[model samples]
Target: MGDGRRGSIWSIPEGQGRGSRPAYSRAQITGAAIRIADADGLDAASMRRIAADLGTGAMSLYRYVPSRDDLIELMIDHVLLEADVPERPTGDWRADLTLIAENTRRMWLRHPWLAGLQRPRATFGPNRMRLLEFAFGALDVGFPIDEIFILLDMLNGYVERVVRGEIEWAREMRQSGMTPQRWMTESAPYVRELLGTGRYPMFERIVMDARLPHMSAEEQFRYGLDRVLDCIAAARP
Candidate 1:
């Protein structure tokens, strides 16, 4: 004997049952939630708001989405459809990883709320599964599975770190009119004073000799990504 409860939204069939067709769909609800989140951040995408956006009662949405957690998972997966990766990885692992990295960055920028999701969940929605296959399969060289996991983590970690910084910087600019160029210009006197002391050799070198700080965000990201890929190349058998 088994209970008739469904554990996950993914497991539940859409509009399941032979009654009159449902008034709204999970896709419609999820899409509305995404649009709200994109415009006003994640917390604004409440069930009530989403329902109002669809011109229905909030209670009616529960019949389709069940719960807020389920809705969030759906939203997360729905945006990943924009990642637009190929059906299969090319044999050139570096090129494949580069494609993944670039697409992932663009996706996160388009959905800055994604950077706010701190906890990792085991939700394997279809788009997520496809991306996981492409990323894991890209590193399907001679490395062991565990090593492949580590390598992918390393690559994703780098991308996440850089993209998070970019997201926050953009937010800061919007909120306070702060940008790298403006900050550099405003802080140049203090930076020069510090450099004049010559006490911090590495700091002075970074100030004087580093091209990274002077480059645009895109240039810096590409340069660092190339270095990371080079490291992966060095580790290869």
Candidate 2:
């Protein structure tokens, strides 16, 4: 969220550069690629589709992006740069973490494909490094750099785990030709029937709560962040 810099480990290789400018200078191409991923999911966002959107041949884009993986990484980081992380939240770590979590949730919602595109193998893009620096800075908790990285990775892994579950559920629902709500409805009768045996009244009572499943990711993110921070606080002398 800071001023643009070559923060990515995957900066275009020298051969791929065009006299200092990136071989591809058109923001339109990148924007179209992002849109394709957003509208149809990352799998639908091929280099060919992006080129078609730009009215160019797919081969031409190769000068800019050597591979589909690069394009996907760039797309994800580009959209990440668009997220608004407010000024540092002073020393209030709780409020700062909440802001970070909400910003992350909003970014994921804006580009659902991002949750799918990211992988453990992918190198740290510049935007990602900035975000990491941001998280550490906001924490301002005096943890060692390695611990900070581990903590951030844990937080990130948790969010991605949740998002990936949602993505898979959405994909399965689409494949089954049923909305999630419909699938839930169809399963409810069987579930209620199972509960009628009286072996799980506590579970039934929990399920009956009006607020179940209504909590937003932002809320969950904040809840998890605070819980982890509380643990850290407790561990302190």
Candidate 3:
């Protein structure tokens, strides 16, 4: 990526961040933008497309959200709001966080376009801010606010990484005209050769037991949540 587009696309424009309240609210425009993103991926979600969805001229949207980057940020926050978090303390902390993580994964799965958009631009909309606060409030840990933020950030980062991998795998499958299993089958010979060596007995056992229940995204999310809860328990006074 060229420096100009790289810097501009991933980061919000300076001065654009502190927008005065306008006649047209950002939430309304952001709602329209998110619909566009949901129906079509980010590349197809142009300013003109969003404007059409909002029944406004493209230039009119600029009054609320100046650049495409701002629209992308709004769209992410809007879709994130689609995630349904349970009421606090209704379940164990591990189960509660697992639910949040799985819901987050489902949100990305529903809106694959979300995986492609740059998150650095999404500083925080009301919905996301509330969600973050809810996460912290639900946790039993005694960490400082900054540490809580870092933990939530790490969780979000891990979920995003998983979604991105799924999206990339889907894209590659479409381009290659082969299923992921087929691709793996074709490469299995080399993998087997490496595993067949006596040095990798554990690796061989793990690979040979392919029938062992592989973790789904939901399972993986729950496992990670359990580990986090363990850490939080250890950190308690």
* Cα-lDDT of candidate 3: 0.68
Candidate 2, position 15, lDDT: 51
Q: How many Å off is the CA of 140 in candidate 3? A: 5.0
Which candidate number has the best TM-score? Answer: 1
- Kindly list the per-residue Cα lDDT of model 3 for residues 1-237, writing each as its tens digit: 112333322244433434574546677777766666677777877778877876778876665566776667677777767667754545365666666777888888888887675663544776677676678876636668777667767667777787787778777876887765677789889887887677887777777775433676456566666776677566545
- The list of candidate 2 runs beyond 4 A from truth reads 1-9, 13-23, 86-89, 118-122, 168-185, 208-211, 214-229, 235-237
- Report the C-alpha displacement of residue 71, candidate 1, in angstroms: 0.9
Q: How close is candidate 2 to the true structure, as a TM-score?
A: 0.74
Ranking of models by TM-score = 1, 3, 2
The list of candidate 3 runs beyond 4 A from truth reads 1-28, 86-91, 120-122, 209-217
Model 2, span 1-237: residue lDDT tens: 112344442754535544565445435666888889889987888878988888888877766666665666677667767655554446776666566666766677677777675463445776666765677886667777777667667666766676666667667776887765677788988888878998988878766874535565446556666777676566433
Task: Please give each candidate's TM-score.
Answer: 0.94, 0.74, 0.74
Q: Regarding lDDT, does 1 or 2 come out ahead?
A: 1
- Which ten-residue region of model 3 has the weakest summed lDDT? 1-10
C-alpha root-mean-square deviation, each candidate: 2.8, 5.6, 5.8
Write down the worst ten-residue block by lDDT for model 2.
Answer: 1-10
